[model samples]
Target: MAEILTLTALGDNYIYLIVGAGDAVVVDPGDAGPVLLALKGNGLRLVAALVTHHHGDHTAGLAQLKAATGCRIYGPDSRCISPLDHLVRDGDLIDLPVGFVRVIATPGHTRTSVCYFLPQTEGGPPSQPAANARCTRPCPADVRPTTGPALFTGDTLFTAGCGRLFECDAAAMHRSLAKIAALPDETLIYPGHDYAVEDYMFTLSIDPHNQAAQQALRHLRDAQAQGRPIVPTPLAMEKRTNLFLRTDDPPLAAALGIRTDDPATVLAAVRRRKDAFQPS
Candidate 1:
């Protein structure tokens, strides 16, 4: 499995470095200074860059990094970003030095938005144990596949919030989110920004009685207080705690005045409310 490192850039934006076998690939490098430092410190070769969209905050460092490291740039075809070495669409598979990533076109925040899915490197069917060995022993955290297949949601899915619809309509965004929702429960999600606390606070206001939301909010708040990074949320946990993902739930629908069971409608309503939301 590749070791993932987070480089905080452009304030809240996150830049990810996937390192394995002395080779590395950067995801959405909003800035180059931190990435250069990380590469120098780790002594890893920058092989390629994976871009999710054309947003400047996500691709501003592309030119500089490519110049310094001679890394290949991969992204959706767009005029906003220049000198693309490869144009990827949905279901495209990108082979890297470590593991491969499958492209998922998730166009909600922008028309060209895409997501990258990398399956966890370990934890398939358990091996047969000895006749006298216990079959129910829990796996050690160190041995477990914590770096399992992860999704790089550019500006589409935040921790508890979804991105603003800049180039697509609500229906399109809903379909895009649905694609993400179909992934395995264990798929870890690494969004583009560190908006977990703010998104959680907004969720608490709407669903104050939601235990999962309350717990997640408290956990994020504590993490923030401790200066820990808040990201890579599990898909199963997000399915339960994220209000944006729960728009189709009957209780949430009712709370949001969405009488119809249509998921797009409910999601649109919730999104509008979020757009106008002000955290207390």
Candidate 2:
């Protein structure tokens, strides 16, 4: 499997480096400085860049990086950005040094928003015995395995929150989120920003009794205190703790005092509450 490196940029934005065979593909490079430094430090060549949207924060560094490395830029079909070499659509696959990345159209954060999914493949023989073996044991709760499929959601999904509705309505965002929710439980979600603390706090306000959210908030606080990255959240964990993903749950709707059972309505209500919520 290709190695994934998370680089912090523009404060909360996350720039990912998908590296393999001495080549790297950058995802959402908000700033070119860190990416360029990383490439030189690691002696890696920039092969390509993947853009999820046309937001300046996500695409500002594209021109600079391309000028430096002459890399190909792949993104949603848009005329605004000038460096785009390939226009990707839903279900389109792009070959990379790591493997093939499948594009998932998620249009809510932006009309051109799209996510890249990298399916996990077995990397040779397992270093340890199978589950049936006598010496097999479960991994610790704090230790999450990184060798799994990954979803690069640029601003569309956060650790415990979804992006604000900018160019799309709540219903459109709901549909976009549903597509992401349908991925495998083990798919690792790499979102664009670091909003764990505020997002989880908001979640607690809505579902105060949610033990999962409570535990997650504590974990996030600890991770933040230690200057750790609270990301690459698993899809299974999000389904359990993310209020946005749980809009369809009856209990979540009741928490919002919403009488309707329609998920989109509940999501709209919850989203409104979140927008006005002041995190304590």
Candidate 3:
């Protein structure tokens, strides 16, 4: 049984706890206030913390969580802003009792930004026997453990939007997003915000004729009305609707008047346009 608990933090950020099979691990606790509430509320014992980047909104409460729960933290060595218990890099897999999560170095959202991909507990080479399965005495196919992966995309990808290129150039941001866009369609895309609906409107303004944005807006509206999560977008879904992920398309280039087909060039134009978009 794999469970990911999400805690709302600092307005839009999401602090995630990937739990199951008797162990629990947290991914980016922006503050201890909400995390403590989540732990106590859900009766969960945090085993570790994964920091995707060093920004305070992502790490401000790390020290306190460690003080309170004594959870080990995994992050980049360059600067997690919080003190690191385990410094990891690209291609390294950290072993937990239940399974393993690989670190994919995805810089651009920040110089140290990295994404964690958690492998499912079943059907890979040799399935890890579920000490106890949750769905049934014998887990069924539909309820069988997911065999793909789950991604915790911090500030890099939002619901229908991407993070602002604060420190990294548009080119680097585009490259980083491309890496994320290549993941399997089934991979869950948990992001750091609940800011999808509004951002989708802004994005729509840039491409008023875009149908996918309209569909995403409708989806976001319904999810918001029902108080649901608007993220964990599939890779194929992102390729379909996310303007930032489609920076090289001709319509996008035409929108920005850029002639180059290079991904970076297209990113420059898109960012330039969004950076100038002001609500009327």
Candidate 4:
């Protein structure tokens, strides 16, 4: 099993290191300083780096890290970004020392945004390519596992919120979120930023009656007070607390005073509300 480490950079951004067999793969490295220090401290070799989007905070460290380690850089097919050794697309898999990192296209935060899904292997390869797995409308039943699948959602999905629709419309973001919701309930969510407290607060603003969100907020507060990192949230916990993932929930729609049952429409309304929201 690969060991995952979270490094904070640029104040709020998170850089993840997946270490196994003395080899490490970093995801969305915003700063090379912290990553390099971590690699040296752990005495691990940098094999590859995965990018989820072309944002500066995510890719700024790519060129430097690659220059230092000579590691392969994998990311979306976009011209805005540079130093990409491999340009991947939806359903594409990049083999790493830890395991296979399946690329799932999630364009909303940006036109080229993507998420990386790493499924756990018990001493062997997966039963089949995860790209071949069929996904249904709301959720997928085929991807569920007991434990050890991690989704690197960079600016796409947060603890209780989703990314702003920078280059795409609300419909596009909603579709991308639906794909993430299809992952296994036990799948751990390693988002690009540390926005748990603010996000959960926003979730409560939209879903005031959600006891799960209330409880989660309290837990997050306690974790923060204890100086613990609040991340790698389980998909099951997000399903219960994240408003973006609960667009189809009738109560949430009612709370928003939206009459439509269409998730996309509901999501648009919620996103607008969130855009205008001011935290107290």
- Provide TM-scores for the models: 0.90, 0.91, 0.85, 0.90
- Model 4 ranges with Cα > 4 A deviation: 121-147
lDDT of 3 at 266: 82
Model 1: residues with Cα > 4 Å off, grouped in runs: 124-146
lDDT of 3 by residue, 1-280 (tens): 4666556777787877776764668788887887776666556687888888888888888899899888898888545366689988888899875468888877777877888888664433113323223333321111223345678888787766777787788878888888888776667677877767766777787788778778888976876686554555555666766778888788878877768888888877776776777755
Q: Candidate 4 residues 220-264, lDDT tens each? A: 898678666677778888999998898999888899987988998
lDDT of each: 0.81, 0.83, 0.72, 0.83
**What would the per-residue lDDT of candidate 2 be over residues 1-280, giving only the tens digit for each residue?**
5766677889889988887777989999989998897787667799999999988889899999999999999999668666899999999999998789999999987887999998885542222212213112331111123477889999899998998889998889999999999998878888999888898899989888889889888977877786556777788889988888998899888888878889889888988998898987
The parts of candidate 2 lying over 4 Å away from their true place are 123-145
